[model samples]
Target: MSLPAPETPLYNHPLPQLERWLMALGCQQDRGDRHCWLLHQGDWDAELSLDTEELVICYFPHQPQRKVVRSFKYSLSRQDVEAAVLEGP
Candidate 1:
């Protein structure tokens, strides 16, 4: 399905469109958990979870043994979340 404009709030998109957007960003859905997605770049890995009211992201090894976690409310514009997430931790 086609998605809304990038400036539109995420809450305005349908679930499948959101999933597609994530997939377009090179994220793979967790096989065991439909609500979770995973992404790996050359230098880092991240897990993104679709929560009840927000999208949560955890980046591995923000430090030697720690993961950096961040959350974005669904009310934010799709472009804003995309920029923040693509920026990495």
Candidate 2:
């Protein structure tokens, strides 16, 4: 199925569309936990969790001993979340 317009709020998306969007963005769903995903880019890697209320992301090796974590409520527009998230921590 196709995704809604980028301006649409994530809460308006059906689950499958959301999953497809994530996959399109290069996220791999965790084999053990269906709600979790992993992304690896040129210089960074991140783990994403599809929680009930929000999308949570943890960027790895922020300071050698820490990770940078962020969350976006599903109420936000898909485009807004995509920009904020794919932009990295």
Candidate 3:
């Protein structure tokens, strides 16, 4: 039940759409009551967190607070992420 074809490029995806897509990707609940969620991928060794106001992706291999951040309106698609780089919360 996912949209946005993998090949599809992203400019900006609404927060609701991105949130739903994230939930479907096994995003662990950080604060479900507050809309904060985190997704971890062992293979990539990366963790991404998103809430109502921000998106943050941290590379475990890097230093702390070195996460990528973006506006809540940022797109969740790979293309958008790659283009914007990982954003801070």
Prediction-by-prediction clash tally = 0, 0, 5
89, model 1: CA deviation in Å?
Answer: 0.8
- Which candidate gets the maximum lDDT versus the true structure? 1
TM-score result, candidate 1: 0.93
Cα lDDT tens digits, model 2, 40-75, are 877678999999999999998545657899999999
Look at candidate 2 and tell me the lDDT of residue 77. 99
Q: What TM-score, computed on C-alpha atoms, does each candidate reach? A: 0.93, 0.93, 0.42
lDDT of 1 by residue, 1-89 (tens): 78899999999988999999999999999999999999987667899999999999998854576788999999999999999998888
**TM-score of structure candidate 3:** 0.42
Candidates in order have lDDT scores of 0.93, 0.91, 0.51
